[model samples]
Target: MRLFLVIFAVIIISGCDDSNSKPSTKLSEQQSSSLLTIKDESVIPETEFSIVFTPNNEVEIIDAYIEGVDMYMGRIPLFFSRTNKQLQYIASGMVGVCSKNEMVWRIYLHYRKNGTQEGKIATLNFVVTNT
Candidate 1:
């Protein structure tokens, strides 16, 4: 009975560990499929994050906004500047806060030369790391 209990506890602990450490972003074919890479793999709510854009064509970030998918977090504008050559887009401050453990946030990246009206929409449904 002791051995069985220990094994059960071990299994429960291991199962609680987060498996989705690396967040994945999905974009349609028209949106270039995979051009946006969130700097840090793990993202937290109401935190600043930089998005690195790697496009084949000449790109210019006009604007970027993030919205909560599962809930209504409102459309918040992310920070971005043409001069900031390093982080094309940056999001911070009152961005997202959810009641659940995981909240799906989507970023609508509006950039020039992305071959779409206004900008390409990318749904970044990622798991928010610990508080």
Candidate 2:
């Protein structure tokens, strides 16, 4: 009889504690704006530039290139079957060059499941000066 009473008391206390817990609220716009914001007003150097692609699913990154530069092309096989969420890929070899001019780049992603084309092209302008 004592063990049964103790068990019942424990369950009742646990239920009461959970009922008294406050629900979580979403963050306000002002609070969240700066959390994930990117400030692009300031000019960044060309050598500091890179290309990024957010994939919608498990994808094999076929190639990333600076559009007109054939030598800049490269491939990467990515597996995201565990999660169909967004995944990011960054372009390589163009890290730090002082070339403050506009350039176009393309990132091509191949879905592993259906073999469909998921490509993205981005144009960025930044100043690059010889260091």
Listed in order, each prediction's TM-score against the native is 0.60, 0.30
Error of 2 at 82 (Å): 14
Task: Provide the lDDT at 12 for model 1.
Answer: 39
Model 2 lDDT on a 0 to 1 scale: 0.29
- Tens-place lDDT per residue, model 2, 35-102, is 11112322232222233444344456443323222222222222222223345445432322212233
Collision count for each candidate, in order: 0, 8
Which candidate leads the pack in lDDT?
1
Residue 4's lDDT in candidate 2: 43
Segments in model 2 whose C-alpha atoms lie over 4 Å from true places: 1-46, 68-86, 92-131
List per-prediction Cα lDDT, in the order shown: 0.54, 0.29
Off by over 4 Å in 1: 1-22, 82-94, 114-119, 129-131
Error of 1 at 57 (Å): 1.3
